[model samples]
Target: SIFASGTNLDVVELWFPRLSDEDQMLAVARFNQITSVQGSAMAVALPGIVETLGTLHARSYRLGVATNDSTSGAEKTLVTLGVAQLFDAAYGYDAVANPKPAPDTIQAFCDLTGLKPTQVAMIGDNRHDLEMARAGGCGLAVGVLSGTGTRESLAGIADVILDSVVDLPDFLSARVKETI
Candidate 1:
């Protein structure tokens, strides 16, 4: 549930409810340090992710990241995965006043890409991501099963539910044909 509703800071508050405000913040800092050490150790890219991103790029589709993680953290992971060059933009929670479940991240992407909200597709693995897409009036809200979301969580919100990002190219092709 942390993935859906809270950040690492929220974890400190949730787990140590008895802690005073000052102590909770201290706990958060320690928690962040622990996770930061673990983060780089677990930065592996999903299978075919690089290829999938390359496929999108070759088609001149804009690509980027919108994550609950910090922008610099996302960028570091991308660089570690050797896919840093594939993305056109990367926005994280801190980049916007309101994070997921709000329109901020999607709007940021659209603004930078010169895209109308209706021209954008928001692909993610959580209900918050889909909610944000809807709030921003995105053309498509795609949910993938690879991370925190489940079928029940995403069903009413997503325009499509994919097994994972590897399926994106085929899904995109199908959508293109439908329009044609």
Candidate 2:
């Protein structure tokens, strides 16, 4: 069963028994193939995501990825997508004792980037991301209608729901300008 909790931030918890080493390897291979295909095919950034990340990176805002995937898997995905350098910090399950829903990975990212939790925003495509961000005390929790996260799935937990990542930069820029 899938378990989840939190509001404006949620934890999506999947209950799966530990995989055997062989199964893990198989899972990784399948994941790699799927991710490689998706990354290679997406020639454009998700509407506003790239611009936001790029703008933030250029402004020296600490950028990080806290994921439940393995380190190698995350690295491969980022590299394949040609966005590895955008992140100032990256944390995966292998990099921490606990993964999403536990908050360890996000906490590790905060530690590595030297950013307070309130200075960070967690953008994700799932309930797990929302939960993790909330648990980690992220300032904002944004859900994208990408991957498997549907509007209903991300409702309530997300402070803002975007159609794609492409909207992020524009949204953030507007917010920052308003604050200034």
Candidate 3:
């Protein structure tokens, strides 16, 4: 994913190591311009995302989003999808010391919500999300196949894997039952 490159430092240091610092800044600025402008148009809520998130919200789940997107871009996209109100908080790359594959965002989620890592279930569609969850010591790290990641890619990282976000409610219900 384009966002995997993260900030200017990430882009220069990881993606284009040979780029001059000045060039890296220019690249980052251009990338941000394109992404921010196209962000809303690119916001495609997958099938069942709204319904599933709505159901969870109705059940009083405290939902949040931690993404590599810019905060304004994430908010705009979520609002465009008509699901922004469902989330209690939304953190993006700039909000934390580090982005995904590090624990900063997840830790920010915990801090913002007054919840412990053990009380959180991190559900994502990619390896970075799962890795972030793991790094944060979340209780559950779940992977969904609806996005870029394959089961093979998420194997051994996610505690449980689901076909899509729509399955989450049932999966949570089953987990509750198991505990009882």
lDDT of each: 0.83, 0.70, 0.84
What CA RMSD would candidate 1 show?
2.2
Identify the superior model by lDDT, candidate 2 or candidate 3: 3
Best by TM-score: 3
For model 1, the stretches where C-alpha displacement exceeds 4 angstroms are: 16-37
Q: Judging by lDDT, tell me the better candidate of 1 and 3.
A: 3
Q: Write model 1 residue lDDT over 80-108, tens digit each, in one string.
A: 88888989888866678887788998888
The sequence of per-residue lDDT tens digits that candidate 3 reaches over residues 1-180 is 554525534654577778887988887677666665697778888988899999999988889988887666777788989999999888877678888879998888888889999899999989999999999999999999998899999988999999998999999989999999
Q: Report the lDDT of model 2 for residue 168.
A: 75
Which segments of model 3 are wrong by more than 4 Å? Answer: 1-23
Order the candidate numbers by lDDT, best to worst: 3, 1, 2
**For residue 61, what is the lDDT in candidate 3?**
83
Cα lDDT over the full model 3: 0.84
User: Model 2, range 86-165, lDDT digits (tens) per residue?
Assistant: 98766765577777777787778777777788888888988889888899898999998865688998898999998887
Pairs that collide in candidate 1 are none
Error of 1 at 115 (Å): 0.7
